[model samples]
Target: MAMITWITDDGRHRQAEVNDGSNLMLAATFEDVPGIDGDCGGCLSCATCHVVVDAAWAERVGGPGDHETVLLDTTASPRQPHSRLSCQIISRPELDGLVLHVPAEAW
Candidate 1:
C-alpha cells in the first residue's frame, strides 16, 4: 500500500493508504477526501478529479496525458503548472508518499 496525502483548498489535510495499481481518484473517493469529485470515474473525461501535485513531488508524479490535458482546459479551477487529473495518476510503490493539493472546486 502507498500512503497518499490530500490537502484541501480550505487548508485541511486527509491521508489514505492506497493499494498499488489503483489510481489517485479511486483512493481519494474511497477515503471520502473532500474536493475531488471524480465525476467521470477514471475516464479522463470530466476533469472533476483535478489536483495540484505538491511541487516537491512534481517530477515523480509527472504531467497529464494528451486526453487529460485537453480535459483539464475545462476544469472549474484554474490550471497550475503542476495541475493534473487524479484519475490519470496511477498509484505505485514510488508514489507511496505522494501529496496532492485539491482545488477549491471541481465542476
Candidate 2:
C-alpha cells in the first residue's frame, strides 16, 4: 500500500494507506478527509476533488492530463500550478509519500 497525506486549507493533515491502483479521490473520501468531495465518484466528471500537490512532490506526482486540465479550470478553488483532480491520481508504490493540499472549499 502507498501512504498518502492530504492537508486541508487550515493545515489539518489526514493520512491514509491506500492500495495500489486505488483512485485517490476514493481513498481520501474513505479516510474522511475534509475538503475532498468526490461527487463524480472518480469518473473525472466533477472537480470536487481538486487538490494542489505539495511543491516538493509536484514533479514526482506530475501534471494533470489534457482532459483533467479542462476540468481543473472549473474547480471551486483558484487553481494552482500544481492543481490536479484527485480522481486522476492513483495510489502506487512510487507515490508512497505523496502530499496533497486540499482546497478550502469543494463546491
- Candidate 1 residue lDDT tens string, 1-107: 78999999999999988888899999999989888888878987888898999999999988888888898899899999999999999999999899999999866
Worst 10 residues of 1 by lDDT: 37-46
Pairs in steric clash, model 2: none
TM-score of each: 0.96, 0.97
lDDT of 1 at 72: 86
- Model 2 lDDT per residue over 25-44, tens place: 99999999998899989888
Q: What is the C-alpha lDDT of each candidate?
A: 0.90, 0.92
